[model samples]
Target: MSQNIFIIVCIIFVGLLIIAEYRAAKRLDSGFLKWVAKPAASLAFVLVALTGGALDTTYGCWILIGLVFCLLGDVFLIPTGARTFLAGMGAFAIGHLAYVGAFLSTGPEISGLFLIGSAGMAGFAILALRWLWPNLAEFKWPVTVYSAIIAIMVATSFLAAPGQSSAPNWVVIAGALGFAISDIAVSRDKFITHQFFNKSWGLPLYFGAQLLLASSV
Candidate 1:
């Protein structure tokens, strides 16, 4: 029941955020102390991930530190939404870097890794460039930003790639892909056209990614 409530609260929180950002259409700066729940939630989430023994091994405590900043970025950057969003992106980027370190990689099956991840990346790129280009043409500056995110996501499956005998290769791949899917869903929420998708697909996809990420430990 607690887990269920947590999920519900998360859904409501994100939904409200989307609504608030859209309605305000202005970036709001939350002073440091004004928003504590985000960091608190992130810390609790990491604690749960650790205690749950995600990915069959221990993770660096530093990742929690990064996530704390991510929550801060998310909460504060919602108004103008650009810089703060980018800050959150930076936080996640660093967090992924930590995951790369925590991952005692056995070198991914380059054959499968390159083939799948590259293909998805290429597809998303082409689709975005060809079909969605004009829709986002005004925000050309952010093209690089989205591109970097794609690059990181393609490495998503790589994080779980068979680490130190305890980490199975398949599990790593699943976890990475799950994370990618969540980010993809997040992109859908931000760029795509539809609130129903945000509620139905984005939230669930993010949870799926988080679940898979936890499985990594």
Candidate 2:
């Protein structure tokens, strides 16, 4: 009961923080408030996982680690600059690897679901790169590699056992999709256009994804 309450509170807090950050971002303000609120939102999801007893299993621990890296990515992206941007990308890449580890913890299996999902994600990655490549400049290869890594992370979720209702694979898949959408929004805003409106879509997708993953544990 206590754990449930904590998770609820965290969810509420994440909602509020995401809204706050969205509003602040629209004002072109990556101010102290947004910086603080953005990370707080991620922390809330991490707390949800921890409080929900994700620490009880090895897979859960890997999930927690992935969330932590995402938190780090969030913080690293707060500042405006290429160095920090790359840092954030590196962090998120590692986070995706951690997620891949968590998904594989259950054991490996080759299934139609995995193949289909991987192919779809690969197609999306190609399209996204096709659009983003010209603008990627010196970051082209880095972005390509990271995109492939994240696609693999999403594909790995389909490898989870399918027979159980509480298997958490579906939730993981939803979260991975959310994460991918959020990143697309971010890339568009950062490289294709400069606008806070992107945050309107990005922040919610990101927080929602993290929360979904948290609940999976």
Candidate 3:
């Protein structure tokens, strides 16, 4: 399939997911909606892998691995249990590391700008941890570790591609930022308070980010 067709299909899936999730947020009887949407989100990435013309390269494969782990994380998080949450975190951590590997494989040149971005990511992680510390109680450490890994993933996304000025590079960076924002919404809704509206923004950011990352393939 052509890239244009793939993009259009992905967009349709994302729209469907957002609508389903919004209904779920409203406490409507959306049977299997979340389940369907989660996997469909991941499947969009798989489609990119198949059609983006990059599956043969090691870098592409690494990204594929990350996306698979993300699928696993999504599934694991669906069940309501602390164990499942931890399992999801582990899966996503591995996914982030895989993404980091993909970024390093490009042999990005170390620059002051890159270091600054890394520092910015670190600062955001620190602030998020500080805000969650009081409510974290038992899950503090695990969340901290997972957050750090995700921050690294976002930082690396900026430097993953060879050229900083390229459209692909910016797309990857935007996806990473969107992922970060979505996660923050998740954390707030899950740990601090129960806000249904969080899903409204978070779901779109998440699927959009995944679609953008998939396109990077």
What TM-scores do the predictions have? 0.61, 0.89, 0.90
Q: Candidate 2 residues 54-171, lDDT tens each?
A: 8887778888999999999999998879999999999999999998888888776688888999999999999999999999998999999999998899988887542244344787
- After superposition, the stretches of candidate 3 with alpha carbons farther than 4 Å from their true spots are 162-168
Q: After superposition, how far is residue 122 of candidate 1 from its true place, in Å?
A: 2.8
Off by over 4 Å in 2: 1-30, 162-168
Candidate 3's residue-wise lDDT over 50-142, tens digit each?
687557666677787887888898789877688998898899899889888887777777766678878999999999999989998889999
lDDT value, residue 6 of candidate 1: 43
Worst 10 residues of 2 by lDDT: 160-169
For each candidate in the order shown, give its overall lDDT on alpha carbons: 0.49, 0.81, 0.79
Highest lDDT among the candidates is held by which one?
A: 2
On the 0 to 100 scale, the lDDT of residue 29 in model 1 is 43
User: Which has the higher lDDT value, candidate number 2 or candidate number 3?
Assistant: 2
Looking at model 1, which ten-residue stretch has the lowest summed lDDT?
A: 30-39
Candidate 1: misplaced stretches above 4 Å? 1-41, 52-80, 100-109, 162-168, 194-196
Clashing pairs in 2: none
Task: Evaluate model 3: give its lDDT.
Answer: 0.79
For model 3, state the Cα shift of residue 185 in Å. Answer: 1.0
Q: Model 3: which residue pairs collide? A: none
